[model samples]
Each structure stands twice: as structure tokens, then as C-alpha cells.
Target: MQRYFVTPAGLTETEVVLEGDDARHLATVMRAKAGDPFVACDGEGTEYVAEAAEVSPGRVVGRIVQRRASASEMRWRVTVAQSLPKGDKLETVIQKGTEAGAYAFQPFLSRRTVVQYDDRKEAKRVERWRKIAKEAAEQAHRGRVPEVGAVASWKALLAGFAEYDAVWLCYEEEGRAGVGLKPVLRAFGSSLGEGETPNLLLVVGPEGGFAPEEAEQAIAAGAACVGLGRRILRTETAALVALAAIGYESGEMGG
Candidate 1:
């Protein structure tokens, strides 16, 4: 069934009111009629199986059939902190990362970053990235949309390290030294207490990767410097690989 993320106001005791783009998509694109089934999520973990009750111009109302639990989210809330890469590589990361179970995306400007940070275009760009995440989340059957944070400065990124339970910085130097992600994740996983849901931050630098000092600062701020493997991954690829590793290690990928 098609899934739609509706706001709390859009969901009531008995109905789901999809408005704007979702309404248009259901009415025109999907050609949904009364009784057509779909799934609705409130983006706060509550989900419902519903059928179309009314379809009109710019509005589609769905009658709630039953509430269902969606086990699509990873046990760990892993946020990807990516340094702004040139071109549309960030878009690819956000899309693929969402499908791979990233809880959120945090874009930051690093020292080696070549793309100039433009404050004027920041809002529009972030908005587009969020839309990409939303579409990807829906396609991935995720109950909640991944958050796309505004680009942060290097210092700001480091300062925010305290917010997460653990931070892993993807460093090529570590990869060259033969340090792999598995052992680090294993150790971290072992440290978790019963019923604990860890907030993991995976940091990946830009095309040139992080500057020596940048990595040093992150480490000092409590981030664990880790490698994906012997082969260094592109900035865009690192986060997705890490997310997959997290899911597999957490048993979300199955035995």
C-alpha cells in the first residue's frame, strides 16, 4: 500500500486528511477512489492503515481502519554528519542513506571543503535535501522521515558531539592503517546497557576528506576515529556503508 506522512493535525480520531502535495498525488497521480487502501504515519511513530473516504480537489480524506506498528526504523538512531561535497553528491547520500536507515542528516562545512558556503541559498538547498529525504523515506517504507539539518560550521559540528551517545569519524588514515569499522562497532555495541537506544553520529568528510586538524579536533571532542576498510570510500559512500554496518550489527539486517 502507498504510504503518506501526515502531520498530527491531518490525523484525527477517525480520519486522515492529506492536503497539498500528498492530496494531489493521491487524487491525480494515484487516482485513488473511495475504499482504496493506504498507510498513514504521523511522523511521531504512530501509523494507521486506512482507506480513502473522500477525494476532491486538493484534498483526500482517509478513514482509519486500524493502527499498526512499523518495525522499519533501526534500533540505533544513527545520524550522518556529512561535510558538504561538491555537486549533487550530498543528494545521493541523503537518498541512499535514508533507505539504509539513517535517522537524520547533518551537513557541515569542513576546512578542506571546496564548495563555498552560501548563506543566501542555504534555506532553499536544505529544503530540497529534506524533500529528497522524505521521498526516499516513503519509498523505503519508513514510519518517520529523516531530518535534514542546516549546514553547520566545523566548530559547531564539533561542539554538538556531546549530544550523541557516540560519534565515529570516518578517517582515511585509519583505513590505511588497517583499522576496520567492525571492531569499533562491536566494542560500542557491547557497551550499550539493556534497553538503551544509542544516538550514533557518523561523520564523513568531503571529496578531499577531513583535514588533519579537523580529525584531531573531532577525536578530542569524544569521536572515535574509525575506518570502513582498507579501501577508502568516497565521502558520499562512507555514510551509507556505516549505516548498513550499524543495521547489520544491530540485527536489523537479520541473522
Candidate 2:
């Protein structure tokens, strides 16, 4: 069954109306017709087993058959604070990172950042990133699309360290100390508030990586510097690797 994320406007008391791109995918690409069964998700973690009730050139209406909880989302919330990488690598990061169960993405300007988005063009870039995330989540059967946040400076990124249960800075030099991500996660678990779900933020540097002074400032802001094993991963690959590491530690993989 195909699944489409329904915005509030597309949802009604007992039916969903998918428009634009979703409608084209269903009505034209899928060749859907009345009574054809599919799935619909509301981005609020709700899924409906539905059947197509109406189909037009650019619209797909489906009647809800059954409702159920979305089990695809990770139990532990993970956000990737990625330093802007060159070219379209960030698009790849958002796509696969969402598949790997990252709940949000924050692209920040690092000391070594090579690309700069002017304020006049930043909104357009953010909009494009969000669309990429949405399509990726749907393809991966994710319950909700991971949010693509606006760009921020290095200092602005460090200011929110206390908001998460744990923050890990993926540094190339951290491997020398033999500090593993698993132990860092365990330590964070021990300190989390009762009844509160553990939340983690992984900070990945750009192509040239973070400057030493920036890493020091991040450490002082309550982020633990952790190694993603001994290999020097690319800026894009590092975030997904870190996410997988934490997911494995949480026992959420290989079930």
C-alpha cells in the first residue's frame, strides 16, 4: 500500500484529500481508482488504512478504513546538528538520516564552512530541504518527516546544549582518547529525568571539520566530544554513522 502524509487541510472527519504532488503520484502514476486500498499518515504519528474514494487529474480522496499508531519512529529522539557541507551532500544527509531515524536536522555555519546562504535566499534553500526530507520520509515509511531547520552560526548552535539529555560532537581527534559513543550514551541515560524520553543531539562538522577553538567552546557548553570509531568519515557520512551507533546502543536495530 502507498502512504501519503496528509496536512490538516487535507484531512476531514473520516477522509483524506491528497492534492498536488501526492495526487499526481496516486491518480496518475499509481493509476489508482475508486476502492483501491492504500495508507494515509497525518504527520502527527497517525496512520490510516484507506481506500480511494475519488480520483481526478490532480486530486485523490480516500475513505479511512482503519486507524493505527505509527511504529516506525524511534523511541529515542535524535537530532543531527550538521555543519553545512558543499554541493548537494546535505540533501543526501537529510534523506538517509531520516531513514536512519533522526528526528530533526539543523544545518549550521561552521568555522570551516565553504558555502554561504544569503538571507535573501535562505528561505528558498530551507524550503527545498524540507521537501527533500518529506519525500525521503515517505519512501522510508517514516511516521513523520524530520524537520529541516534554518541555518545558524557556530555560537548559536552551542547555545542550545542544555536542552538535550546528551550532545555529542563528532570530532576526528576524539578517537585518540578511545572514547566510544556507546559509553557516552549510557552516561546520559543515567542522568535523564524520570519519565522523560532521552533526547540526543549529534554535532557533525563540515568538509574541513571544526576548528580546535570551536570544539573547545562546544565542550564547555556541555557537549561531550565522542569518536565515531577510528576511520575518518566524510562530512555527510559521519552523521548517519553516529545515528546508527546510537540506534544500535538503544537496541532499536536488528530486531
TM-score of each: 0.98, 0.95
**Candidate 2 error regions (>4 Å):** 190-196
Model 1: CA > 4 A from native:
none
lDDT of 1 by residue, 64-128 (tens): 99998888988899999999999999999999999999999999999899888899999999999
lDDT string, candidate 2, 144-232, tens digits: 98999999888888998899877899998887667778788777666666546677889999999889998899989998899888888
Worst 10 residues of 1 by lDDT: 38-47
Q: Residue 94 deviation, candidate 1, in Å?
A: 0.6
Candidate achieving the largest TM-score: 1
